[model samples]
Target: MDAATAWLVAAVSLLAAVVGPFAAGHALLTKREPQVATAWIAVCLIFPAGGALLYYLFGINRVYTRARKLVAEERLPPSLAPHPTSSSHGIGPEYAEQIRISDAVTGRPLEPGNRIQVLSNGEEAYPVMLEAIEGARETVMLSTYIFETNTSGRQFIDALSAAHRRGVDVRVLIDGVGEYYTWPRPSTLLRRAGVPVARFLPPRLIPPQLSINLRNHRKILVVDGQRAFTGGMNLGDSHLLQSQRSHRVADVHFLFDGPLAQQMEAVFAEDWAFTTGDERTPPKRATPHDSGALCRTITDGPNEDLDRLVMTLIGALSAAREEIWLVTPYFLPMRPLITSLEAAALRGVEVKILLPERNNLPFVHWATRHILGELLHWGVHLYYQPPPFAHTKLFVVDRRYAQVGSANMDPRSLRLNFELNAEIYNRPIAEQLALDCELIRARSRQLSSAELGERHPAERLRDALCWLASPYL
Candidate 1:
């Protein structure tokens, strides 16, 4: 061979030797699923350079390292310190295990004396939130997955700007991907008004971090560090009942008071600190109440605490006795959750799930359809809510316990993105949520086993293809 040809061959061989084993070894060590590891190894062996770059940018979990460092450097105020024991929170002994597991996962104790108000839709939630922002005496913190620049978004912008002008400490955090929903991002408006704002994991090309998959999906709003609002509602005109928009969505949100609100503030503070590198003092504790509802805040993400929401759901489902009523926009749960739901059904516990008939994301809807046969065969009832899509996420167990938050039933909410939910041991709230589920079910069409099995062959093939992409969807 010529010298030039020989030199080229040697370079290619060196590149292969270096990239192939490195990517394979990294995948084997880091990837928990064997299929994922095998896929990475094959890509690395066949297309060495591109595969190595893809693995570096997307496969590796870089957030853990940064999150761990920040967590270690963070100092909690005396008010936010962990309590000695979370056992005596007035939660029944039957729920002792669920409470303990949640505390272990979130590192936040179950707090009592919490007063929760269920806001039926954006009309109810937005007014209360704006009022709280206007009356802020100390600080206002807001975080959301989507902050569209529409009529409702402008209202929030004005309220926040007015609060900032009044010398209230106003800070806002919007997801990097969610800010592109409109021509001018809402963060720009907030910044123009001199409100402190930061985008979580904004898109970048230099470092090549494909952070688009990892989003901050939590919808949280805290005012004066004592009261907070959160759930699935985002800042968009579609959420308004009077919006003339073609597509509108209905959702539920909660306004919280007492110590549970403090926990919500802590989640926002840590996220803000991580994004801006700004140290934050723990929020002051709200005045304790002698008697009220019991609640706990559960935060989960791909950072240090991973798959926490999934684990918590599985645990709750396994322990459910009478019935499970779940409502979500998306419905693509992991294998373990599916198994737990099946088990619950086998034991004669009613398992009913409510999902939007026409989801905003067509691919996700198709994927969810592919799994319905299995669940239906196992005696789990599936109901589809007819149109003007519903974005609410809620779960009620035995009409006595309930969980509501921004997390959906899909893998994105379970294992990929950052999510927060409130677990309530209050019978009144659970009953109200159950009634809401009943209302949704009243408008929903339940699919029978035979109906699910009657899907056309071509449609089934399409659904199967979409189901294959569920892990990343």
Candidate 2:
């Protein structure tokens, strides 16, 4: 071979050798499922450098998104929201209310008459949560994916420790995957302090056998078996909001004091059961009374079709009569939901999606942009909230139905991971969620097709790549 050709060949060969395995390693680190890892293997073996770049920019990122199998026993029907067989999409108040009660004692609803309060962020959520812990009259249950051992996490631990000290039943559950890194793990700290702490699905070390994507993404806290709190918020030190995230985050949490709160209490019980092999403290049997809210507790795990959360949201979108407003930090909905949002706008449902201008996951940013123009064209209003990456997952429909939880709009939150969301049929909760969404919209910049089209070449290329990774983002 000529000298120049030989050098070129050698350099490219060297590049492929180094890049290919590195890409595979990156995928392994991100918890890419075995199938995706295998796909990466094919891509790397075939295209070499290009495959490695594609996988790095996308594929092997966040293994938690892989199609991890949920313990089959946990998955409920996709229609947990109630059968929409009737021409009317709205669930009957009686039916929805019954779902809340039955979720705990039985898989049915009870009359709800509890108060619901929206807590803005950790600054607001933590204190109230601690107070609840302090005042725990009976059992105290807490579950979360990320439980930091930082300033805020310590306070909750102390409160729970105190509750434990007070001889109240206190059970704390933390995702084994999310809190895997600690001196002995934060749960250990709680356990040593005489509080019972359980880890959910601790990672088992298996080399080259990738795929443990089924993660518990729900963040739920219940005290006294009567009051509960849930939302996208995790117990971490990233207290308030910041416009620019130099590694920052923001979230929303809600407190409930009705029969609806009992549902969250039950979700915690189920997880505590799944992990610790123990059941929740039996409820103080009282004649179930109404707390005055129409609600349902719907959960989705593996062993069922993927994207149950998004599918549930699609149900709302399909039934949307007036306006559909959604906010999620990472917005990679599966095809059906993507189509549903577009169709909703096309069919005259006023649809709006609020996302972060720059989320922690930029590849997700690209994925969301790919269809932004399509949505905008279909009369869907796309708005980008200025940063700190508000991690609130909320949906509002016609001032009637609302959903809030830790699940993002992406497939990972829907299909691959365990997610908890409360479906509220009351007008007040719906109105409140809608108003908050509007407040967030005020801080956001609306995007149009013209601006997206005007983006620089490099920026556009990145977005296209992001869209390609949308399925797993």
Candidate with top lDDT is 1
lDDT of each: 0.85, 0.72
lDDT of 2 by residue, 414-443 (tens): 766778887776787888889989899888
Q: Judged by lDDT against the true structure, how good is candidate 2?
A: 0.72
In candidate 1, what are the lDDT values of residues 1-473, reduced to their tens digit?
99999999999889878987798788888787888788888888787878887777667656566567436244322232334556666566877766756666666677888888888777888889999998998899999988878777888999999999999999999999888877588888899999999999898888764667778999999988778898999887878855667798889999888888888888898899888998678889876567767887887777754577887788789889999999999999988899999999999999999999999999999999999999999999999999888898999998888899999999888877888999998888889899889999998999888876889999999999999878778
Model 2: CA > 4 A from native: 1-111, 181-184, 206-211, 242-246, 281-291, 305-307
Q: What's the CA RMSD for each of the models?
A: 3.1, 7.4
Q: Residue 17 error for model 2, in Å?
A: 21
TM-score of 1: 0.93
